[model samples]
Every structure is written in C-alpha cells, then in structure tokens.
Target: MVTRRWWQKLYHRSGSSTAAAASTRTISPIMYEFEHLYQMAMEEIGYAIDSQTSSYYAYDLEDAQAAVQACIQLYNQLPITDKWNPWAEALQQLQTRLDALPLPIN
Candidate 1:
C-alpha cells in the first residue's frame, strides 16, 4: 500500500511551490505548457498502474517505468530560464526518490 509519508514527499518535491509561484507571478505560456505536459505524463503513469497493466505483464512494468524516468530526465535537463524552471529541480528530486525505492521481489 502507498504510504502518506511517501505521498507527502512526492507532493512537496514535485514543485507545488513552483506551481504556486507561477500562478502568483504570471509565469510564461511555455512554462505552463511544460507543467501541463509533466502533469499529464504523471497521470498517465498512474492510470496505467491502476489498470493493472504493469502487474499483469513484466514488459508493461518496465515500459511504464522507463517512460516516467525519461520524462523526469527531460524535465531535469531543461534550461532554467526563469522561476518556472524550478519544476526541473523538483523533477530531479522526485527522480532521486523514485530511484531509492526498493524493487519488488518476484
């Protein structure tokens, strides 16, 4: 089962602060688009897991995980042109947390 502590860390590290700043400071359209894409990718990963595709097939799990990792890597690599780019930093933190999680045993 998912733990509250994990969720809390994820929420904080995934740039809730950056999003708030963006709303309060009139962030650019391009930054907003990046945020939207990041959110969509996260939602897709959740949906895939919820649908049991990952558990029913080993390849599905690997593919989904790889997709998420790729997105996170891309976000972390984006140039920090403005305050909105803090999302990239946040993505890096999230990726580190995910990497630290223990793998499930077969």
Candidate 2:
C-alpha cells in the first residue's frame, strides 16, 4: 500500500489524472479578472502590434494595456509557470508599441 502526496503526482510513475493536477496557490478575483483581461488583450494586441492594422481599435489597446499592467502586478506575486508566461509576455510586450493612441480600426 502507498500513500502519495499531491506533489508526488506530477512525477510519479503512475498514470493517474491527479498527476496533471497543479499545486497552485489560491488567487483572488484580481488574478481571474486579470487573466480574462489579458486574454482579451491578446486578441486586440495582434492587430496593433504586428500589422498596426485597422482591425484593432485605440480603446481596445488602452483598455487592454491598463488590464495588462494590473495583471502583471497580480501575477508578480505568483510563480511564473508555463501556464502564465506566454500570455504574460505578450501583454508585457504589448506596451512597446510606439503609438498607444486610440485609432479607429475599420
């Protein structure tokens, strides 16, 4: 008989769904909202970052940037896992644009 802790699950030799479970710290609503906002930004930042196309609007960039800043503040408290890094990097870089002014994307 064996009793394994949750941390053991990630690297155990068994094929249990518990191995896929994450040992994440509980987060406040801010983290949830920040992730939601960052996801929204990913959609909008694409238009402004690469193409500077009219598909993304100024209001969208502004709103998303604000959200990203807030997201970073909250995310900073947690361990930077693979789950958060990708979008976190995108949102972090979204501010590098030369122009953050609102534009009316057609």
Candidate 1 per-residue lDDT, tens place, 22-52, comes to 7786756655555654664465345445545
lDDT of each: 0.52, 0.48
Question: Estimated TM-score per prediction?
Answer: 0.41, 0.36
lDDT (tens digit, per residue) of candidate 2 on 1-106: 0112211322353434322322244555555545544554455455445544545345445544554564566566655553456765665575554245455555
Cα-lDDT of candidate 2: 0.48
What clash pairs does model 1 have?
A: none
Q: Which stretches in model 1 have alpha-carbon errors above 4 Å? A: 1-25, 53-79, 83-86, 93-106
Check candidate 2 and list the clashing pairs. 58-102
* Each candidate: RMSD: 9.8, 14.1
Task: List where candidate 2 sits over 4 angstroms from the true fold.
Answer: 1-35, 47-56, 79-92, 97-106
Question: Positional deviation of 70 in candidate 1, in angstroms?
Answer: 6.7
Candidate topping lDDT? 1
Worst 10 residues of 1 by lDDT: 1-10
Candidate 2: residue 74 lDDT (0-100) = 57
